[model samples]
Every structure is written in C-alpha cells, then in structure tokens.
Target: MLRRWISTLLLGLAAAALAGCSSTRLVDGQVESFSTLTALPAPATYRIERLPSQQTPAFEPIAALAERALARVGLQRDDAAPRLLVQIGVQASSVPRHGPSAPYAFYGPPWAFGGWYGRPPGVFGGWYGPPPWAFGGWGMGGPTPLYRRAVSLVLRDAQTQAVVYETSAVHENVWVSDPAVYGVLFDAALNGFPAPPHGRRQLRLPLPPPAP
Candidate 1:
C-alpha cells in the first residue's frame, strides 16, 4: 500500500510540473525619491477617509492598518498642510472559483538587420504568461471548484488626489463574517509600503540616452 501511495504522489507531482512552471518578474520601480517623496510638508491635520465598501466593518480595519503603517514610518495622523491624507477602502467578491488572469509580457525584438521579428511564445512557455488558473477547476471555462479572493489598500495625495502609494494582498478564502481576518488583510496591505529611511529609496527606471 505504501509503495502504491508513493507512486501516486510522484505521478501527481509530475502532472503539476507538466501543467505549468513557476516564474516571477519584478515590477518596474517608478518612485524617483523615497526619502523626500514619502515626507510631506507636515499637514495642518491628518485625516483618514474610508471609501465606501460593501463590508460595513472594513473601514475600521483599514484605519487600524493605516495607523500602524504610518507609525512605522514616523508619521502621525494629527500633523497639519499636514502634508498627507490617507484613504482606505476594502473590496470583496464571491469566490468566483477561478484565480486571477495573468498578463502577458511584452518583449520588443532587437532591431537587428534594421527590423524586429519573432513569434510570441505559447502559454506553455509562460514566455507568453501563465494560463488563467480557474478558481474551481482548469481555465475560465471549467466548473467552479475553489474560491478566489483579494483585498487592496490605496494612498493618495490630499491636495491633488494623485495616488502616491498603494498595495494589495490576496488570499483564497471566502469573504464572510471574519473581522480578525479582515484586520490581518489590512496589515498585509500596509506591509506593501516602504518605511522611514527605506521609503527614500527610488524606483530605478532605465535612463534615456544623452543627446549626441
């Protein structure tokens, strides 16, 4: 019986490997200056706003999450022009039985011989990208079998309403009747931002060539 079980496990592992290989890509860093950037001119008073959410209790959890996150970076809500304002909102949807769709990578071919050329790689290569993992079963077409869920937190400039920061954390659990879990989700979103001295770090984008 043990031998049979071992054989079955190995087969399952092989099947998963065949279905897809895992890979990660770093998002482009867009922040030019973390230090001066995260620092606001010291607002006259800090204010927290909760965007309307279907979950009535979501706002409180979001507030707690923001408070903790701000404290970590040596910011307090009471300060004035007080330089910054935070908005927190929560979004939940029924476990749709499918995971999120992954976007494709765009790789411009080298301009060799004065022009570009190449066929886009297929899904299996993931050079094209991961196939949409259905929540309950296979691709989007399959029957729902599992749960799909996520939460997001956003930060914006008080004056311009331009988003200066944001973060999201996801989990595959049903979104119902769990206040503790919601708070934790907010914390996870807070983890998405850089703190204090670390905040000064800039996202390094490829610099353009200097004029000839």
Candidate 2:
C-alpha cells in the first residue's frame, strides 16, 4: 500500500510538470482590407517598419523573420517606392495564475492506545488523521506567473494610406523565450494573407524541435 501510494504521488507530480511545460499558441485577427478586393493583391515591393517604441537592436532579428514571411507571400524588400508597408509589433506580459489546490484535507480522531485510527466517542470531533497517501499536497503551492508573447503584423497601401491586411498571434507558456515562437507567430499571422477566416479561430502549430 505504501509503495502504491508513492507511485501515485510520483505520477501526479510528473503529470503536473508536463502540464506546466506544455503551451498553447492562439492565432486570431480581423482583415479590414480584403472586403473590397476580389483577389489577393500582389504588391510590387514591400518594406517592414518597426513600431516607434520597438526600434531597437533587439528587434532587428525579429524584423528579419517577419520580412522572410512576407517574402514567402510574394513581397520583396524595397527601400523606396514600395507598394505596401509592413508594420510589425511585439508585446509580452506576465499573467498570474493560482496554483493547484491541495489534494487532500486531514480531519479525524486522535490516536490513543491499541492503534486507534479515528477520534474517540465524544460530542466534539478529535484530531484529524493524515491521509493514507503521506504526500497529499506535494505540488500545491503559491500563485504561478505565466508569460504571454504576442506579435501583430499590419500591411498598408503606401499610396492610398489605407490599411490592407492585419493579423495577430498570441502564445502562453510558463516561460516564453524561444525564437521559433515568433517565427510561428508570424506564420500564423499571415496564414491566409490577404484573405483570412471571418470569425476568430484557434490555431495550433507545432514548435520546432529543441536544438541539441
């Protein structure tokens, strides 16, 4: 019985650890510019611009990744006279979540002689005995903070100054740092490009394998 209880506790801890590591990436957005257009527009050239606050060296690599995604969708980098301008922005935040509650509560009688398990016969209850499983609240703890990373991409007609397309992707995890997260975000942001699903939709994309 003791060994079985220990095994069950270990399994619960393992399952909780796996759950903490698992993350979900949510991709959803609206396309304000695709309504008037009949077919996906092929711009001659496009230029990527970072948000005023995001103009920093750290964002350079991220911008390059966004550019690559655009290129895949038939847009070439151009400094001057580009038909479309791409604006990329990134936002990250920490969300606090309450940890799992204790699994078992101890309440029972006090032990006396003859290995008495429960409380004695009395009006008020005796001391509560610990659960059969020695390690009942092993993993339960304080609030855990989770990190969320989001990326937004917007495309505008250079001449008309009208918003053509836009999309955003958000990911939640215990710790969000992998560069592949942004890559996947951009991919999901531009999934349908000029045309996307009308209503909000959930997108699940597999993350790249960890480097050896």
Top candidate on TM-score is 2
* lDDT winner: 2
What would the per-residue lDDT of candidate 2 be over residues 123-210, giving only the tens digit for each residue? 1222122211223323344333444556777778888978877677776654444466666777777776656764456677766544
The CA root-mean-square deviation of candidate 2, after full C-alpha superposition on the true structure, stands at 17.7
Per-residue alpha-carbon lDDT of model 1 for 1-212, expressed as tens digits? 99999999778867766663333212222121122244444542446654443234423544564576566555577634444566554433332333466332222221101011133211011111123332324443554432222345455567887766665544443222223333444455544344333332222122222225
* lDDT, each prediction: 0.40, 0.57
TM-score of each: 0.40, 0.63
Clash count per candidate: 20, 4
Alpha carbon deviation, residue 120, candidate 2 (Å): 61
The root-mean-square deviation over C-alpha atoms between each candidate and the true structure, in angstroms, is 16.7, 17.7
Worst 10 residues of 2 by lDDT: 106-115
